[model samples]
Target chain A: MGLPPKRGDLILYSVLAVIFLASCAASGLLLFTARGGSDLVLEAVLDGKVVESVDMKSLKDESTIEIRAGGGINVLAAGPGGVKMISADCRGGDCLRMPAIDSNGDVIVCLPHRLIVRVRSRGPAKASPIDSMTY
Target chain B: MNEESSRGTMIRGPRKIGMIAVLSIVGVIGIFLIDTMDGARTVTRDGVAMNTVVSVTLVSAKPKPQLNAILDEIFALIGELDKKFSMWNEDSPLSEINRNAGISPSAADGDLYSVLETARRVAMLTDGAYDPTIGSVTRIWRDGTGEGRLPSSEDIASALPLVGCEGLKLTSGGEAYLERRGANIDLGGIAKGYALWSIRRLLREKGVGSALVNMGGDILAVGDGDGDRPWRIGIQSPSKDRGTPLCAVRAANTSIVTAGVYERRWEMEGREWTHIYDPSTGFPIEGDLLSATVISADPAEGDALSTAFMVIGPARSLDLLRILPGVDAIFVLDSDERGMEVLATPGVRDSLEMFDDEYRLTFVDVY
Candidate 1:
C-alpha cells in the first residue's frame, strides 16, 4: 500500500491539475484562433472558368503565370505569402493597381479579360455577414 | 489517524485528478464547438459575367454538395443571361438586333423581348432619360474615351439622332427592329438588375431563405444576411476610394442598384467625361450629381432609375421619387460649398448609417 498523501501534497497536485486543464483550454483556443497562411488557396478564373487553383503553401518559390483571354494578357505572380497581378494589357490596368492579396476572400479582377483571382481559405474562418456592396 | 480516513484521503486525490481530466476533455470539446459554431453555413462563389464581377452568397443548412449544386445552377444562369444580353459579344441577341437595324427584324429570345418591353416602359417613365436606343452614342463614347480621345461633335451629332426610343421597335411576335441603320440598343443600364431579379426567384424556388447576389454593383438581398438579421449593404462612395462606402443600409428581400459616373470616367483636355450619357445631348452627363443609388422590389427598375437620375440631376430625381411608390433613391452630388452632399429619399433615410462627415446628408420628403 502506498503512503497516504499529506495535505500539502494534495494541494500541490490540485493546483497542478487546474493549471494543466487551463493550459489545455488556452492552447485549444490558440490553435483555432491563429490563421494559418498555408490554408490559402488561390483560384484564377478566366471568362467564368476556373483555370488555375494553386495552394499558396505548395509554392516554395515565386512564379508568374501569363493568362491570355478576351484578347488581353494578364500576368499574375504567386508566392508563399501572397499573390498579385504584376502586369496586364487590359485597358485601365485596374488589376495591376490592386494590391497583393494574402488574406482569405481577397479578390483581384481584370474586367476586360474577365479574369478574377481570389483567395479561399480552407480553414474555419467565417465569411462576412454583410451581403453585398452596390456601387 | 484511522486507516479508513487515510484511505479516503488517497481516494479523494484520485477523484480530484479524474475531475480535472474530465474538465480537460470538456474544455477541448467546447473549444472545437466554438471554432465550428457556424460550420461553414455560408458559401460564396464569384465569377465574371456581363463584363463585370458576379458574386453569389448563399446561407443554408443543406449539405455542402447540395449547396455547391445550387451555386453551379446560379452561375450557369448568369452565363446564359450574359450570352443573351451582352452587346460586346458579337453573337449575342442584342448584337443580332443591332446587326439587323434598318435591314430587317431580328428574332429576339422570349427573355430578350420581355426585357426590351420593360426597357420601353422605363424609357417612357423617365421621359426618355433612360432610353435604350442610346447605344449608338454610348458605343462611340466607349471606344473613343477608352483610347483617351473624346468623341468629336460630328460623331456625337450622327449618333444623337439614333438615341431615341422610337428607333427601337419590339413586336409582339418576338421580333425587334431598329428604324435606322446605325441605331443600336444597349442593355448595359438594366441587364445586371434583370439578372438579379431572376436570381431572386431562382433562390426562393431553391428554398434558400438567405442569399445575396451581386452583379457588379447591382445587389439583390433576400431574407437575413446570415439567417438572423437584415443584410447590411454599403453604398459606394463617389468621391472617396472604391471600397469606401458613403453609408450603409440594412436590406431584406429587396434590390439595391447604384450607378455612378465615377466608375468609368476619364479626364481629358481638362474636362471629365463619364460613361453615363444624356440621350438628348449625346454626351456624357454633366451635373452636380455624381452617383445615384436606387432601392426597390424590382431590380430592373432600380437599375434603370439609378442611371436616369444621373441624367436628370438631383432636383428632378427627388421629385420623381416623391411620386414613385415603393422606390427610394440616394443621390451623391458635388457641392462647391459643401464639397459632397447626399440626398436620400424618406423610405431609406431612417435606415442609413452615415460613415463619415465628408458628406452632408439630407432626407428628402416624399410628400
Candidate 2:
C-alpha cells in the first residue's frame, strides 16, 4: 500500500549500501591482518621499563640475561616455552624459587632487583578479565 | 499512473526523512563501536617498593603518554610511601621514630599517624596478639634468618620484654614514640595494606574507575575489571612452593590480604620459625592454621587481622570474626586428623572456588 520510491530515496539507499559494504571490507581486512603473525615474546622489565624482549617462538637453547640493577643482580633464562629466574642475589632468594612463566599473564618478580620477567603477546593486546592472585 | 504519482509525492517527504534518521543513527553507532575498540586500552605498570613487587593495572581511554604519566604518578606515590614506611630505609620517618624511641616523641606525618592509629586499634582488638612494637623480636629474627642460625633463648627473652604495644604512645597531634628505650615499631604486617589503600585513593583521584593494585600478594580491586566482571583473585596456597593458588575469590572495590607462615620462614635445627611473631611469646605463632586470608574494605585492617588470626588461632579468630562486620576471613589449617582443611567466613563461602583438591572447604556460619 506504500507509495513508490523517489529519486532522493534511491540516492540515500545507494549511500547506505556503499557504507555497509565498506564497513564489511574494513572489518574483514582488520581480522585478517590482526590474526596473521602473532607470536609470544618474553619481556624483561626493570624499574617499570622493558629492558629486553626475546621472541619465544625463535628461542631454542637456554639464554640468560643477567641484569644488574636496583642494587641487586638477577639471571633470567629463556628457553622454548617460557622464561624463569635461574638465579638472583636478592636476600630472600624468592625470585629463584618462583615457577617458570610459560604463557601470557605469568610473571616472576624479584623485588630487591626491581625486576619483572613475563610473557607477552607480540600482537595487539587482548583483554583478559580472568585473574590477579593475592598471596 | 497519474494517481500513483500524486500519492508518491504526498508520502515521499515523510518516508525520506525517516530513512535519513535511521541511517544517521546507524552511522553514529558504528562510529561509537570503532572508537571503543580502538581507543580503550589496558595499561599495566610494575615496580618494586617496600620490599615487594608493586603492580598496577588500569583500563583507560587516554593516549599512551597520558597513561604513562598516570602510571608514573602511581609508582612515584609508592616510592614516596616506601620512604615513609620502609624499616630498612635509614632516612625513613619510621626509622627516625625508631631512633628516637623512649628519648623523645618524634613528629610524624598525617599518613604515619593514621597507619599507627589503625595498628593500635588492631593491637587492642587482638589483645597484644598483633602489636607493632614486636619490632624488637622481629629484628632478632631477621638477623637470625640472615645469619642462618636461630636466636638463643637469652636473645629471644631479652627481646620479648621490649615487644609490647603498651610502650607505643601516639599523640593526637601527630607524634609517636616508644615508652622504653629498646622498644621498636615494625609496620611490616600492615604497610603493604596501607600502601594499597593509598593507591586506591590516588587512582580514584586520577579518574581511574577500574584498577588492580598488587603489593607482593596483597591486592586491592577498584571497581569491576575488564568485561565488567568482579576481579578474580587467587588465594595463595600455604605450601613450600610459594605462589601456588589454593582457591580464587571474586573481589570488587575491596582489598584482599593473606598472611601465611610460609611467606617468611626459616628452618634451623629441624625447626621452622615463621615471621608471624607473638608479642607475648617472642616466637613464631605455633597454631593449627597455616595461613589466613582476610577480605575487607580497609586493607590495613585486613592486613593486621590476617596476622592476628595466625597468632590467636582459628577458634579465637572465629569468635572475633563473628562480631566483626564487613570483614571475612579464610583459614587454612592442617588438622591433626584431616590432612588439609580450609574454613571461610559466611560472606566468602560462595565467591570462593577451590583449586586444590587436597584441601576441604567449609563455611563458618556467623549468623
Say which candidate scores most in TM-score: 2
lDDT of 2 by residue, B65-152 (tens): 7778988988888788878987777899999899898799998898888999999899999998889888988898879867888888
Across residues A29-120, which tens digit of lDDT does each residue of candidate 1 receive?
66655543337778887755678888877755568877787788888887654787888998788888776777666788998888888877
Per-residue C-alpha lDDT of model 2 across residues A36-82, encoded as one tens digit per residue: 45677888788889887888866665877788767878888776646
* Reference contacts preserved by each model: 0.63, 0.59
* Residue B193 displacement (Å), model 2: 0.4
- Give model 2's docking category: acceptable
Name every residue pair that clashes in candidate 1.
none
lDDT of 1 by residue, B1-367 (tens): 8999878765876766667667766876776565545343777778888778998888887766888899899888888988999887898988999988999999988779878888888898899999989899889887886787888999999898887787788887899999999898999899988888888888889998888888988999988566556788988877665556788998988999998988866679897778888898998788678789999999988898899999998888888887789998888888676578888888886688888687889988877
The ten-residue window of minimal lDDT in model 2 chain A covers A122-131
